[model samples]
Target: MSATRTFLMELHCEEIPARFLTPLWENFVHLLEDKLEAWFPTGDSANYRKNAIDNSTGLYSPRKLAWRLVGLPAVQPDQTETQVGPPQRMCVGEDGKPTIQGLKFAEKWGMDFSAVRFEQPAGKKEPCAVVTLTKQGRPTVDLLAEALPGLIAGLHVPKAMRWGNSEFEFVRPIRNILCLFGDQVVPITVDGVTATNTTWGHRLYHREHPAPVVIATPGVYESALETAGVAVSVEARRTRIAQQLETLAAEVKGRVVADAELLDTLAEIVEFPKIVRGDFPADFLELPKEVLVTSLREHQKSFCIEGPDGALLPCFLTAANRTDDPAGFVKAGNEWVLKARLYDARFFFAEDRKHPLSDRLEKLMALTFQRELGSYHDKTGRVVALVKHFASRMSDDTDHIDRALEAARMAKCDLRTLMVGEFPELQGIMGGEYLRHEGAHEEVWMAVKEHYRPVGADDAIPGTPLGCLLSLCDKLDTVAGCFAVGLIPSGSKDPLALRRAGQGIVRILWERGWAFPPADLIAAALRVVGAKATKPTAETNEALMDFFRDRVAYQLELAGYAGSVRRSALAAGWEDLVDLKARCEALSAFAEDTRFASLAQSAKRIGNILKDEAPSTDFDDSLLAQPVEKVLAACLMKLELAPDQASLLHALANLAGPLEAFFNAVMVKCEDPALRAARLSLLHRLRQAFLRVADFSLWQ
Candidate 1:
């Protein structure tokens, strides 16, 4: 038995973009693990696996990407290699003696002619000549040295750059490559840089100490970097920044406005994080809270501070890469940059407010939403029509319908505002703010602002009824237009984000319990889109509905429904998303009953028997001659007539016994054609009842 070892590799490069660091490191780890696992299989037992790699640790900063694999075997186990050669017929002579081909094949594998055997490989029509040999495994260090260079080069990033005279490209120029196995260097090389035991520290913070940090072993890498003033671990830097931000915010009697995404980005942007608290003129707080927060985060990578009541406090915190700001230079620089950004924001706001959101409607005609789908102005018209169509169905009040229509007309107007032009994330938010400032109706403004709700899976749905209706109209119009223009999402390509739009519609309908049929909504939206829609009406309607069905299943899955349960519910019909969700929930709970498995199997049996046979559900009760069939019919009648027991689960439960008995005694395929058709119809009714809840046949 061989002892385990630790392997470490670090690639230090020019500053990587903050967004690319984490994903790049993750890709590197995935590639390394996949290759290593193949080279060293865990085998049958946990003890055998103990010799394979254990924990894998990946860390990244703007300037470095590092990975550590622990508990790796010093050498891979010897493997059995099988080499397949030419067909046995080609290798054999007429007399069954060794032919030239046979001899050459044996020699190629360093085996005698006697060692060659004939065996058919999978998917082959003829048996082929094969030779098996035991190959000795090489030392882990040598294997790594040969494999790491290519592995590093294979990493995929959003963008790559070439430097110096070399044709090699990476996210940035490679400055250093440090590779160590246990206490020894593995001798890997990537690009033009060769691996060594030495790596640089924080480029600016360690300038005074100015000597390369020499790591003697994989175990000392983290501590050694810490001594050199570099926080190599991303989590460590994130924690330190978070704690410092809280301490700084506490000093001002405010809390940091939490933004997990910005926090993650800032964590990767710096190596050794030093918090700098800065303030801008209080007048900046008068800007909409979203504008101030977005400017602070987007422009400066800073966190805004909020008072106890959640009002913006005109203060922000930034994470600077240094040990200390003894002269307060970092703080002053951050404050100056923030002030400049705020001044620009204020100017944009003042300019945008000069004309109300309504006045900007004409400007949208110039902004193309999609080349074929027309302009923002065109989309607004479609959305307004959609809102009118949906709102009428959703509400009978004239005021509610009018307010929703107004919101749809003004939702995209902010795309022309200078503030929104400067900050695209504030499009919907700016529209609402401008409307409110103009003294528009509160419902209309709120609807415009919240129409883009539930932007991500975890985001909140629109809070008000009018907002929900308007959101559905807006999202439905976008999905319908894009899908009509042949922009449907396939595989990983969804340039129009039709998937997200579809999901937003699903989440709003399911969460808000709206009962509008998705097909009707698509039809209405297509009608509003008019000639811009090129796809055939029926074909476009089905594609959009199928897209929505998938979104519904996805949302239900996210809500913790099982795959079979979701499939079953969706299999029945997803025309009404809210009803589909309710069915899923009921089926999920009912699946736990002790009789569920047998009943499900029986339901599946009923489907199999009735497949391709659609008998009229209106069967003659007099035709149910068998006592067992009579019992089943009676149970179904009691269920249908008993209005008090109308719940789907209860109906399913009551049929379980009668269905089991009916299948046991009734012969669905009988000698008598009329009686057979009657029995089939009876089974069909039972299947229909099952489908009312779910297509139980889809259950595993």
Candidate 2:
């Protein structure tokens, strides 16, 4: 039986950038789990399966990433192996004792000459000397000493830099490493820092509380750090920050509003969180909510507070590292920073509204959107043209069409605005705000505001048709522009976010119930932008269609459509996403029937039979030499398939009996060339019918 012990390790570094801290810890812990499990798998699979996290777990704060494990064995189990040497005929040489070669083998394995026994063979009547060697289990501390350093060295970040002339590079320079098991310090070194049992608590807290926190035992490390004013539980620290923010919001009659991403950033930036609710002038609330929130969260790392009536409050909450802001000095300082920020917001807001969006159009030409694809000015014109073309395919309402075109023209003009320049995230929102202030049409304002909807995977689609049209138009033009410059996304690199644009296009049309396929519009967009493009129009048009098809398959896959169904839809061709998706779903359901498998099998057989031949459907009926052939040929002519699934399957099922009989009775490759051609032609007619919905060969 192996003795189990708890283990602890802390990588204390110079304040790691808050963004890199979480990922660094996560990547290191994942590597640690795999390496530890491989080298030391718990034979007790039952317990290992029940409580896996206890085997290895991690926590992180601004300057530290650490882990504590329970149930780690004290040492590896003892192992024994045998090595064979010279035969016994030579060993039992003259005196019925070991020979020189056997004695040499005993010395090689550190065993006595008498202990080196000889193994006798049954058939050959020969014997050989064998040395049985026992390997003692290594101490867990020694094993850890070797592993932990390599693990630390292996940890990487997005932007790594070597420090102090050392070849090792990381997000930041390592100041100290603490690795402990029970009460013993594990010997390890990383980037010139040696491991120790002693660790310092919160940096500032150490100044007043000056004693070093000795980790007497691995199990008590976290609690000891807590006593020294440092938090070790990443989740608990995040929760405390949230709870304190909530308590502060109640006193001010407001609610703390923050995205999960912002909260995560805040949690990693502080070890001991102290919430400070500071107020600014109420007049600054007149600025857009996004401007106020962006200024606070992005700049100060503070969360915006909204009052009970859903209005922005003058106050915001900041999570500071210090526990005590005695005499309100810190609170006053925070208020000063926010006031200066909101003052800038107030200036950009007032100055930008002074001019209509049209006045900024010429200014857009000066700033390049994409060097190869021309300017945002050029993009605006293309989007307008594409939106009008898409609107014609969508609805008969010219009012909405005209509104969509106008919105597309003014959409990116806000990129040149002073307010949007300072707060780039407010590009579309500011465009809508400015257009509304200038008494633009309500539809145009709505279109501008919602044009960037469904920004991410789960983001909502536009609520209005005009919004949908404008959004689709904008994304399609970008995709076209990228393809025009021969910048199609390959592998994981999508610099222009073409995948998101493709996904956004699919989501809008599918959600808005637009059955029009995007292929034609994509082709039209190519014509709009592909004239002077470095790449050929035909080449990019093909790539763009393939891009949308992939996004379409991805969307259906997320919707739980089977791969076979997806393959079938892809085979049929992707003209309309809505129509293609419906076909996929119908094929998936039709595939569930037991009889459908035979039909699928026959379809596959038909494909194999006509692999090289271009069998025509116009084969004469007089060539039908068999009754099954006549029945199938007659059925093919009267076969009328509706777009709906049940109708199409019902029609296809009508020919299944004749198809089965035809395959079972007829010999397709008859000696006569004309007869073989006729039979292949009949199979061609059958496949064409299934091709209307899907290439049922995919079902096979």
Candidate 3:
């Protein structure tokens, strides 16, 4: 008989950061589903069938995320799959009908022609026969036993530890686990929590009187929990927090400053979200709004409220641990933290303004960006030089470029200032403010702030010419300096953020419509700082060049080029990144056309014969006595006259007939040495015809 089952699980922690709950919940749900699928194919399946059965599962996270799976079939249906045989022609005698071969096929499967079916084999239109094999499936109980424990065990956090004699590691110490098959416990345990039929409600809200929840069916388990006063859906928690914040903000004639990620993180941490309003002294509002807000968000984890005109308000809303007495307790706690954070920010900002940004440039000499790399000031020199070269080469506003260069020269100057030293994220922002106050041009001030444009993937690219130039130069220095210092990124290790820097360069150049090649930029920047670089071995330097080539290739590939096209372009060489991109794009354009398949096949065949190795220059054309060879040579000669794409493609088309005729008439690897060399040379010439496109063999 088919029946349903459910699993309810929860862990009581000692104040787990709300931020970690949602991700952990997602991880657990995914792991459980994957395990269940691997075992039964569908959670609804049971031990009663032999075919894959389908199932449904639900996951919810409020303070705690829970998954309920229901409507699972008891077993898989009977297996009835077919094993195909060779074509009927192979099974029939000269009579063109069933022979000994056909008899053997039928006898082997213990079936007659009635159970057998005939169809065309895949990739061929010729008819063939298949024997169906039918077998019953096993019970689902065995599948669940094998899958569940290990799947549950794999649900762990960023860091884990060993507990008790068991080896399972979870984010927190698990207290109880509930696994049910219909109304019966599945009989499982993790850490020390044995599977039960009950789970707890809201921690503090139900503190006075806890309720015992019954885990009957999948639906019953969740409904039972809801009756006990706990919300286990993360979306619900987030909505509550946002709604409460809006309501509280409206009361004070202001709007809640919406920050999704912050709200999301807060929602995951606590079960019962309570928006508590807090206020600071009006005097602190005198500081710049950015400083005030950063302190609130970064340090206090509070949302700063703003008036209708976008002016800073004294009030901030924070998510509290408990709903009771939140107004009194939360206000005091949050206000205290904000006051301390604002004081530090104000002190650093005031102290930093005492000196002009230009005067602090020398101080970067002592700041170490990395252990192997030299001081920050040394980096500034590299950046400044690169920016000047970029300015000269690219068509940008000269005044803006010069201002940008000046700004780049002093961009890292603020790193030495007490403000930037204390708050690293405020580097460019602080530099802009200080530069403007120091009597620098407005362009220079703007460029200083905009140089680090697009700090993340979704962030904006530089718009103004000076902004673009500085962004390009700054990223180039980061890539070059890291490579120079032997700090190249590898699989999963990009501490230097070389990947992000490369991405930034691609975005800036593409957005600004600059036709400059990134490979040329890398080479030029390398030349300027090559002497300062810790010289790597020839092999390592080659690897670094290959790394840059790969970065450019990946960006191009993501822009929608075929893998074959990308490989062909990259295989040609990595002399110029922009040219490589053009090559890939051009090849990709051809690859999409229906005519391309034939061209690709022809190129692939030539590539297969010649490989990448070029034929010996010593070609004895006299040995090519066949008319086909003579015709092919004539075609090659014509192709060499005008080697553009259309001409090359035309030449290849002309050789198609001659090349096919030659392959059919003459042996390529001849016994005679002179003849073989000529044949090889002919094939090599054919392969070279498409070399302007790509080496198709490299793609496969």
Clashes of 2: 1
Alpha-carbon RMSD, candidate 3: 9.1
CA RMSD of each candidate after superposition: 3.4, 5.5, 9.1
Model 1 — which ten-residue stretch has the worst lDDT?
44-53
> What are the per-residue Cα lDDT tens digits for candidate 1 across 441-523?
99989988888987888889889888888888888889998888778899999977889888999888888888888878887
Question: Where is model 3 more than 4 Å wrong at Cα?
Answer: 1-4, 18-38, 41-170, 221-229, 235-260, 274-290, 303-317, 320-340, 395-401, 513-519, 527-532, 535-537, 560-592, 609-700
Spell out the clash pairs found in candidate 2.
Answer: 88-127
**For residues 74-106, what per-residue lDDT tens digits would candidate 2 score against the true structure?**
777666778887787776677776778777888
- Tens digits of lDDT, candidate 3, 126-235: 98887879777554444555655676677667676566786778655666666655555666666666767777666664667666566665566655665565556666
Tell me how candidate 2 scores on lDDT: 0.81
Considering every candidate listed, which one attains the maximal lDDT? 1
Shift of residue 394 alpha carbon in model 1, Å: 2.6
